[model samples]
Target: MGLLAGCWSAAATAQALDAPNVVVIGPNLVTSGQPTAQALARLSQQGFEAVIYLAPSSVPDAVGTEPEVVAQQGLEFIHLPVPFGSPTEGHFESFAAALQRLKGRKVLVHCQVNMRASTMVFLYRVIFEKESPASAWESVTRVWSPEGPWKRLALSQMVKHGIKFDPF
Candidate 1:
């Protein structure tokens, strides 16, 4: 009875939460939804060797503590607070660098709501992960609409990185 209840609870959790794209592109590349202690723990259990944060500065405490916890779990943690629409070359470059560093290691990159985080992940995959433009656009559109300023910036940055996905 207890085992059945646990299974039911897990199923409910999966259904209740927003279904962010959780994909395993390679031996170590994985993506998922928002960040939390339990989420990090699950990532750790699933071989996520690093946690990359792109959350807003206002909610630093909630997302910032993930690094410490990840360390304790014997995984690395890296935080990159990439505000929407103003992502610098340095930020993008550093993020790219981080992704390179975590190559061959399971990495879970996320934000508070996973919108910005997903965009960043899509850009990284498109540019650095060698994912095709079609795949990248599909991956990003799964979580973000191609409308609005934030999406505009995201598409433009992809172009800057030599990804030729159509904006509309």
Candidate 2:
């Protein structure tokens, strides 16, 4: 019975490891595709009151136009210039601070592809929110970022912060 229980638990946890929705990290929060007017509208309809953007250095025309449009929609916007694989200490501090500030507020945080977005979210969930490692990982996978160096950077951030979860 004990062995069966352990196996079942492992399986259950593994199944939960599957990704969650691409949008909406939580019920009131969302992170959509590169800043499109339509995507911003969708997030607004979902009730996100604040938006945190981590976009590529070279923002596209459609994406370039989003911040002003989103702001005009009456949602608060905070933009971070986060190029992949180059997360600075200030970037992590600001990101973590933003996460903390937005706690319980209707917020949406996103990067162009959400690879950096998801990575930051995972670290926030684990370190600040005190979520279980499994739960944090679940959130990470749910909005798994595309293949990039940001993933490695995120793991390094965790190690630098002295979190118990091993990146390896």
Candidate 3:
């Protein structure tokens, strides 16, 4: 019975950690495709301190009440409104700044489907966190390869930050 109970608890913990398109990047960071209100509620329990949304709030299926839900959960919410087709350096700058401000706090970064979120996290990890470029790029590719504007934005941010790893 003890063994069975232990397995059940482990399974329950894993279920609780589940989020839309969830990618557990590390202890301090997670990236997801989209965030529902219910998912936001689970964040605090999962040890997240804040959320960084990389797309506009209206980008198809976004929970319109995210701010309220996040507030209710006592977690900080920051929407960066990155346009999927035209991501700019300004957006990355803002993301990096917000992330830096929240340093050491567990943060969840999400976009419509993890593409934008993954790339941004990859860049942040590689540049600011001194993560291995190859390893961090693995998480980004697990969602999707950044192409078009995403590719351009990723490369440009790398250059701006003086990181020379070409993950393309």
Candidate 4:
């Protein structure tokens, strides 16, 4: 009976999180692909206080009304706009700053499909949150592995922090 309950609980949690490629690092931290307006409402119900969007609103698939939707749901929306083809270290700094301010609050960092969001979250996890590289790596790679510019950014941050982990 206990095993059955546990399985049911896991299923319920999965059902509750309906965003694309959603990853729950903990109760307070989540990363995902673009959340629809309805999904944003669900996130509000789930107790997320802020949404950090990494992709530019100009992206072909991005939701133009995302900011307004998040506001209507009473969640703070922070868009850092990391370009998919040319993410920079400075961009990471801005993201880190927003997260630092919202630290300990329920925050959702997302991009179109979790690739950019996951990589930035991985860096913030290892460097700012002081989590083990392996732990953070596992949290992110489950969504999508970083590559090219994204992978280079992650590797550079690791080097800058003097942490060692080889994902390549």
Total clashes for model 4: 0
Error of model 2, residue 34, in angstroms? 1.6
Across 75-160, the per-residue lDDT of candidate 3 in tens digits comes to 99998998889988888889999999999998889888899899988888998888988989998887888899888888888888
Task: Please give, for residues 1-168, the per-residue lDDT of candidate 4 as tens digits.
Answer: 487775664455446766688777766788888877678767777778999999999977787888988898899999899889999999999999999999889898989889988889989999999999998899787887888998899999899999898787
Q: Which stretches of candidate 1 lie over 4 Å from their true place?
A: 1-27, 60-64, 146-149
Error of 3 at 47 (Å): 1.5
- Candidate achieving the largest TM-score: 4
Model 2 per-residue lDDT tens digits across residues 85-166: 6776578788889877877877777776666777777777777777776666766666564344665666676777677675
Separately for all candidates shown, the number of backbone clashes (residues 3 or more apart, or on different chains) is 0, 3, 0, 0
Please provide TM-scores, in order, for all candidate models, with all chains considered together. 0.74, 0.74, 0.87, 0.90
lDDT of 1 by residue, 35-149 (tens): 4566666655665678777766466446446667778889887878876656666776788888898888767676665666666677787787688867666656656674565
> For model 1, how big is the CA root-mean-square deviation?
6.2
**Every candidate's lDDT:** 0.65, 0.64, 0.83, 0.85
Which candidate would rank higher by lDDT, 2 or 4? 4
Q: Return the TM-score for candidate 3, rounded to 2 decimals.
A: 0.87
Q: Pick the candidate with the highest lDDT.
A: 4
